[model samples]
Target: MAGFLTTHVLDTARGCPAQGLTIALYRIEGGERRHLRTLVTNDDGRTDEQILPASEFRIGDYELVFQAGDYLRATGQAGDAPLFIDEVPIRFGMNEATHYHVPLLLSPYGYSTYRGS
Candidate 1:
């Protein structure tokens, strides 16, 4: 699975999977951003499926935006005026056929992401 890109979201404040959270995938081409797809997290706090298949992997700059504010509001984890970070864009290169496991540790006020195995 080295050629695949995957992600998981965990709500640190709640200590559970951040189900129903919205995420988006994008690729930069010719200085224009293209919307690859939008996905909602499953009960396991993971995308319904892999964002990008291994066969379709390519070497380029990619971004993953996690809709934290809306998720918190809908789940009542945060208030309507939640000081949530709406988006977290992760820019990276697919230099080779490698699996990119991007995991997000999130809270109402902050979030963190990193390359995972």
Candidate 2:
């Protein structure tokens, strides 16, 4: 009965978890997007809690936005370099009342995400 959404981020370029990175979630309703919440990653590159609480989890489409540029820039590696992918947005849908774990592997120029445990 306990089901929710979660996420983890990794800085592939740096070979470590992306700490202090910012992330946001949005719910898509009728083609319009509504903001859910924004969180900064902790030292482990994860939010303190589930992104979507079990009580609020519903069957619908959602999008997660990662502030890749800021994360890269914060590391001081992207200095004076034009960011190729500033914001990485991932859109997905949920059809079951199960835990959705989306983890992101990222670099200054690219990122990848997938459904995880």
Highest TM-score: give the candidate number.
2
Regions of candidate 2 where Cα sits further than 4 Å from its true position: 79-81
Question: What are the root-mean-square deviations of the candidates from the true structure over C-alphas?
Answer: 1.6, 1.1
lDDT of 1 by residue, 1-117 (tens): 348889999999999999998989998878878888899999999987798778778878888888888888777777556355776788777778888889999988888887897
Pairs that clash in candidate 1? 2-98, 2-99
Best by lDDT: 2
Error of 1 at 14 (Å): 0.4
Q: Candidate 2 lDDT, tens digit per residue, 46-66?
A: 999899989889899999999
Worst lDDT 10-window in candidate 1: 79-88
lDDT of each: 0.85, 0.91
- The whole-model C-alpha lDDT of candidate 1 against the native structure comes to 0.85
Model 2 error, position 21 (Å): 0.7
